[model samples]
Target: MANFEEYKNIWVYTEQRGGRLMPVALELLGEGYRLSRERGEGAKVCAVLVGSEIGYLAEELYAYGADMVYQMDHPLLKNYTTDGYTKVMTDAIKAYKPEIVLFGATHIGRDLAPRIAARLDTGLTADCTRLDINTGNYMKYLTDYTTASSSGLEANDGNKGLKQTRPAFGGNLMATIVTPNTRPQMATVRPGVMEKRERETGASGQLVKVKVELCQSDIQVEVLDVVKEAKELVSLTDADIICSGGRGLGNAEGFELIRRFADKVGGVVGASRAAVDSGWIDQSHQVGQTGTTVKPKIYFACGISGAIQHLAGMQTSDIIVAINKDPEAPMMQLADYAICGDLKKVIPELIQQWDEEEQQ
Candidate 1:
């Protein structure tokens, strides 16, 4: 069930939002750059971008590491409807026929990767933390957290070694997984999971503009209108600093303390899953493994306990400050600084201090 000759270069599904590129796209490109070079390949990193008249993005993708950009620009592709994207992406994969496909585990990526994998009839590993080529075993490994396995690679006289490492058991440890079976091996990676490489100064590549043939009857979803919601809910994902509350906050009043502190610091409000589940705060503000993954410059995890899932999202932040009465809480262990005391009193003091500092 395995054929080494059928494999080819690694590929990436470069995603665009409102005609603008998401940060995750660049991150994936950076990784592809590393993987391709290690295999003595010419960074054969290819990008498949499909949208209505959006081929203009190919140049930018090349600058970021795309050796070749396959673009399908069309009017029907303007909006991100599942049907149109799936069809176009499926076509791109069929035509180029890459050995591996990488999708960013972002808002759109999470939705798109699996469908493409299903269409290709290949095994897809979602949220992979790392990828590597093994020369000793000639296997490709996809691993996350402490979970690992091998691709059961074929013997290669022109190779190095393979060792894929990733977080396993909810960020507790790392395990490496190898595909011993499938071709065009696939993996979806989370944003901020990997380091970004230096950009190529004036890096240029080949670009192809292809128009896919389609009929009006082929389109099933009708776009009546685009009702854009103007009301912006406070989201921690985009916040610079988040003052989050959790079960340790005591009750509604404690959460209110967080809101006040957040306001004073000019940061958005946030909460742990415990606070959100208890209805003490709106679900939008939750930050944890099961909630929004945030990498704020500074995070004030007030009264929240740090579970692995919660840390999984926010652990990538520049700095973490946790507050809780229980010194032994998990949050305290992960924080850059921990304060033990009642948040009700501590938060008010912080707000006052912030105000005084601002006035000065």
Candidate 2:
């Protein structure tokens, strides 16, 4: 068994592409900072930055709550390779021994986190929506967010281990997992799930340059070139307003109206899983637990009944406007503004009013 006591700080994998830090990396740092404060033994929030010539990105990590940064720069690591990144990340974990390790649950993160966990013989909880270091906070989260009953829930005030909570069994249940035996408890959090702390301009931190030991023999596949896809997709995470359609739209053609409304409001188009599964829209537009988690400023759910799975993704939006015929629908209850009517008629009227207001 590993000595859990030797672990010190919390480590976040600050993932970047094209020399730009992913928003999820900043989100994790904010969470790591909170966890460090909760752990309360001089536990710092550190960022692990890996790539070639990316040493300059460390300062931004510091500005966003990273107390220290581990820079692993190498030519071979410019593009993400499972073998190259996994080896360096695993080596770093073994050397530094962090108490907690976090990764964003993006395509690359999902691929990379599991490999490092397997290599280190540690446990990793993937797609975690909530993370807590305090037992009371964990239980409170379960009470507020999950359907779990308090009848059997026992609270241990002394437990400071990371408690990772995620949706389970096709979104029907939530499970809280803990790795008490592991030195560094690891988890991959979905994007837009955690809130980012405000950046402190000119903030500085301790920087550690990690020596990269890699060769061609370690990697099986060589990335000759990266071709960006020409398809245009809306960035739902960055959108301030989102106009989404669901199965109640009745047909794929319903998305056309959703698109028009989205265009009018300068918002992006989003869809419930039902609409995407029914071929109403591309999977890229899907917004839900199994899809992308979003927290837009305004989320308009048109013709959606608001199932729990759908709510899990967008419930955190700043304001929700639900339009459905059923006043008793779950979305109506949760919505800040609930409109009971046919979305076909309601949306067009809303568009007309918005246009009239603009004209005046």
- What is each predicted model's overall lDDT from 0 to 1? 0.74, 0.91
What does candidate 2's lDDT look like per residue over 1-360, in tens digits?
A: 787789899999999997899999999999999999999989999999999999999989999999999999999899999999999999999999999999999999999999999998899999998898887777787678667765665576588888898877656467889998877899999998788899999999999999889997898778888787865677998899999999889999999999999999999999999999999899999888888888989999998898788888888899999999999999999999999999999999988899999999
What is candidate 1's lDDT per residue for 79-113, written digit by digit as tens?
77667777777777676667778888876787777
Q: How does candidate 2 fare on TM-score?
A: 0.91
- Listed in order, each prediction's TM-score against the native is 0.80, 0.91
* TM-score for predicted model 1 compared with the true structure: 0.80
lDDT of 1 at 220: 78
